[model samples]
Every structure is written in structure tokens, then in C-alpha cells.
Target: MNVTFRCPPELEQVLPRPVPAKVGLPDWLRRMPATAHDEVLGVELMTVKKCAPFLDAMGYGFLMPLACDLQIDKGRLSWDWDLPATPGETYSRSPVALHAAAQVRGSPFEKGAAPMLKFNAFWTIELPAGWSLLCTHPVNRTDLPFRSLTGMVDSDRYTDNFINFVAEWIDPSFSGILPRGTPVAQCIPVRRESFDYRFEVMTQDETDAFRDTRDSMDGTAGVYRRDMRVRK
Candidate 1:
């Protein structure tokens, strides 16, 4: 599966290149040892198993990093993304005003969801045939100030344009430089296929085996890695 980034010429020098999740793993996670998960529970608040899975979910695809540090002034409804394009033009749109939740509908989860705040996208991604991209907030990162709304694009069939990380500026009080290379979104490429859903109960023998294995492996830390998970 080839996923090409159609970087506009102007952004080549300014935009931080999108990279694989492994390359940009949060510093805290880097110190974690998969073998000695018990010791890491205090600071991380999660067993290695729980934390690993969350990263696994988000780390499956490439991450779109912030092209440049964005300095936003919520009080003034102003911002700056220094991407010099063509002589006089800049890359980003004007700082947008945040909206109140009462002005919109539905129960929103993100911190900035109440306000209809949006910005322009910087790049266009070209996906391979029969593939679509799922754009979502970087996984397992509740620390980020703003929350990105999830969306899907059929990249395979629609290659004429690119996509953006249109998100809510969750932190209203946060007014400063959001350093360059900060991840704004995660893009997961999914193969398109049709299938039906079905529900079935396990047989008596299957149920017994499941219970026995679970009981035997309950205290083991790497059961999924050593016993159940298929080696990629």
C-alpha cells in the first residue's frame, strides 16, 4: 500500500514532513519497557497491556505532523502559521472566531467542540486504489489541547485534491506558540470491502477452552504477545 504525500512546492521548506507513528512516538512512551510493565503503572496509570493497545490503535497508520508552530490568540481571534508562499501570500487562513455551544447542536466531546472553529488544510494526500483514509485525533493523546473531528475520505477514487486537519481549538485560554512538529492528526488507510455481521455463541468445548486459557494466563503480562497474537 503506497501512500504518497502531494506536498505543494511552497510547503516543502516550511511543512514538517508526515512520518510513521513509530518515528514520532511520545517521549513518555519511549521509556516504557514492554517486559517490565508492572513498574510503569504508577506514572502511566495503565498496565503495559492497556497503554500498548491504545498506541497500537493509533500507531497503525502514519501521522500528519504540524507543518509549523501555530501561535493562536483566542481573545483576539487571531493566529499565525508562518508559511511563506509566492512572495506576499501566507499558507493558513485568517484566525477564526470560536462559537458558543448553544449556537450549535448535538453533544460534543472535544474541548473546543462547542464553537464552530476551523482552518485550512496544508497538504493533499494521494492514496492507492481501493483504499480510504480515516482521519482522527492522534490516538491515546488526551494531553493535546484541541480535539480533531473524525472524518473519512475515499482516497483511492478521489485523488483530485488533498485533505486537512480541521479541528476545534479546544484550549480557549491557551495562547502561545504550539511548537513545530506537533502532531495534528492521524491518518489510517483502510481497504474497502463488503461483509455481513453475524452473532454466534461459542460451543461447549470452545467455551471451556477459552475459560481455561484465560484463567491460566490471567496473571501473565505478555499473554497476547506470547500466546494469542499472530506474528506479523
Candidate 2:
């Protein structure tokens, strides 16, 4: 999946040196220090399968609830998942916008309740200079999928709130799925040393967690159906 962001013009002028015009996580990470976790506020990207597991590993499962909040807060962005009527077509879609509802089944908590997480919207944001950072880990079909979630705060308070949300609430609720150990490979910084700029701090992993989830649903009757709404 690809996460795209429109950098504010004012802030865009002060971007850090671009990482050697190459594509890949190492090149991207080497360009910026993992310590630059402070200058990010919001992110916009296509959701990928690998990201789900990475988030779970990082103890970020709590954001599942916030996924719904972001939808209401950020609103939806125009895009397409390119999923077709069949499973083969579904995998063909690249950089798809994944909704929070797709991740959880039935009610978020109850047996028949609707999903509490809803992330259909693309993200948009405005923050103080050096206050927020956005990143994207474009997926390579042959390589392990690389995805990202931007950090949007200057203080630990925001990070702490996120951590607490994951640890105290999300973790307990989804304990069965979360893997042991920290999920994130590292938290990097965004810098502006030259005219060229880069804005992304990525957290990466090797497993195809998202793909695995979707694959697991394969052959399971009534698993990948699209939703239908009845208007009054």
C-alpha cells in the first residue's frame, strides 16, 4: 500500500535532504534518524496486509477504535482498492484503502455488533513546525510489504496516550492475535538539511500479516462480501 501526503507549502520549503533517489526501507531510513519521531501529526496511505501485523506487534492494536475516530475526524479521501467480484481480482488491487471494519468481524465487541473501527477516510492535517511527521512504505509485490503510520505529536504525552491506549485497552481486547515483542523496527526523524525534502518515518517488519489474514478467509463462505445499505 502507498501512503501519500500533501506537504504544506510553507513547511515544504524546509524539507531535509532527499534520500538518494532510491526506493526501499533502508534507503529511506538511512536518510533520517529514527529519533525524529516528534515532527509528525497525520498520515495518508493505502492500507496493506503487512501493516496490520506490524501494528499488532508494536502494541498499537488500540488504534483500531481510533480508526473509526479518524474516519469521522479526517473524513474519507477519494481512492480505489481495485478489488473485483472474485478473490483473484481482490489481490490484484494495489495500494487499497482498507477500512477498519474489514479488520474486525461482527460487532467490535459484541457478537453481532457493527465494527467500531472505521478508517475509510484519507488523512489531512496542519500542525506547528517540527510538530508532526508523515511517512509511507510503498509495497513491492515481490518483497515483503512495507507500510507506515505517522506520529503526530511533539511531546511524549501524545506518544504516551497512544501507548496507553494500546497497552491498557487495545491489547487486552485483542490479546489472542497480538504477537510478543515490540512491533516497530524503529522510530525515525524527518529532517531538512537541503532543498530536497523527505517526510516519512516508517515502522517495518518481514511478515505478511495482512495478506495472511485475507488468505485465511479464503474458501470461507461469506467472508469477503461487500456491504449493502438500504435507504429509507
Candidate 3:
């Protein structure tokens, strides 16, 4: 699915600033030297696209966090993989490690019909300092077609646990209803095959508006699109 980000001028002013800093103390400290930064900056804008099947294979459903982790410096965009050095190796870049840190913050389990699940996954993209924007998407798919007893998570809320639940659901191994020991590669068989799926983006403001409408008592009449195939 191809997802894009559009930031409004007002919101773009709140982004964090990234700066290079030292990571080691004096000789007495006896610690290895490294580099650390609190945030990423110098990002004017960003655009990202992820294949649905590939993302399912990678055990994730969303790339917002991953896209956020990307940093643009000068003219090149770089992803900072905060990795630890091995005994012999000087450095390493693990996408998994970077992913683990990009999770949202909050519980997924609410007090209603929609149950919640959690998984460990995260991604981020760095923009220029003091950059904030009202992000919106041209297309947004709140409802995706899949067969399972498990209820879908609320995508409107960008909580950590919520994001994790989405990841594990698409992951074959972690799927609560699936047989144990299923290889991650085989999780989304339908997605693996030639299946048609679409993705779109919703700006932060737009998402808020949708949620507001959905939250209203009169809004219980929800809408969904379904395309099912049955074998005889």
C-alpha cells in the first residue's frame, strides 16, 4: 500500500531538532565512545510507499513510524539505526531494532466491543528542527477485508498497543487463531498471492474529525466495503 504524508504549515513548527553529540566520558569512565541525538531535523517533507504483502512478511501493517525515522541531511536522506557494537564489529544497523523503538504510546484495549492485542514494533522519520505539520492522507482505509473471528483494532487511534496489535494480526506466527509455529513468511497467504488492496492517507486533523463523528451516538451506523471469494 502506498501511504503519503502532508504536513500543514502551523503544525510543522513543532518538530524536534537533531544535533550531533558525544557519547563517552573520560578515561576513568572506561566506556566505549558513541554518538547520540535526541531528534532529527532538516526535513522539508517526506513521502513513502510500502507493499502490503512485503509489510505482512515483515510483520507489520503500517510504515508511518519507519517513515518518521528517516532523516534528510543536505540532500540525502539517511536512517539512523541506533545499534550496539559487537566484540569485533564497530557498528551495526538493524532495521528491527529501529522498528522496535517507533511504537506509539498508549494501551490498545478499550472498554468496549473491540478487543486489543499488543506486539513489539516501531519506526520513525526525522524532519527539520521546529518543523511541524498537520499531516493528512489522500486515501485512508479504516476497514480492510480479511477472514477471522478476531475483531479489528481501531486504526483511528495511533496508540502503541494499537499499532502493535495491527502488526501481530498481519503476522502469521503471532496470529492468536493460527496454528503454532507457522513461519512468518507464510502469514498472509492471500496477500502473497495476487490480491487487490488499496491504501490512502488521512491527515491528523482529518483523522480527528472522523473519530469525532464515529464517537457520536448517531454515528453508530458505520460503513464498510467487502469483497469476498468462496470456493466450492
Which candidate number would show the highest TM-score if scored against the true structure?
Answer: 1
lDDT of 2 by residue, 103-126 (tens): 445433332332232122122222
Each model's TM-score, in the order given? 0.78, 0.19, 0.18
| lDDT-superior candidate, 1 or 2 | 1
Q: After superposition, how far is residue 207 of candidate 1 from its true place, in Å?
A: 0.7
Model 1 bad stretches (over 4 Å):
31-46, 49-51, 73-82, 87-114, 230-232
Which of 1 and 2 is the better model by TM-score? 1
**What is the number of backbone collisions in each predicted candidate, taken in the order shown?**
1, 24, 29
User: Positional deviation of 59 in candidate 1, in angstroms?
Assistant: 1.6
lDDT of 3 by residue, 85-152 (tens): 44553212322222221242343412233222221122122223332222211012212111111223
Worst 10 residues of 1 by lDDT: 90-99
lDDT to native, each model: 0.68, 0.27, 0.26
Looking at model 1, residue 101 earns an lDDT score of: 55
Candidate numbers sorted by lDDT from highest down: 1, 2, 3
In order of TM-score, best first, we have 1, 2, 3
Check candidate 1 and list the clashing pairs. Answer: 124-162
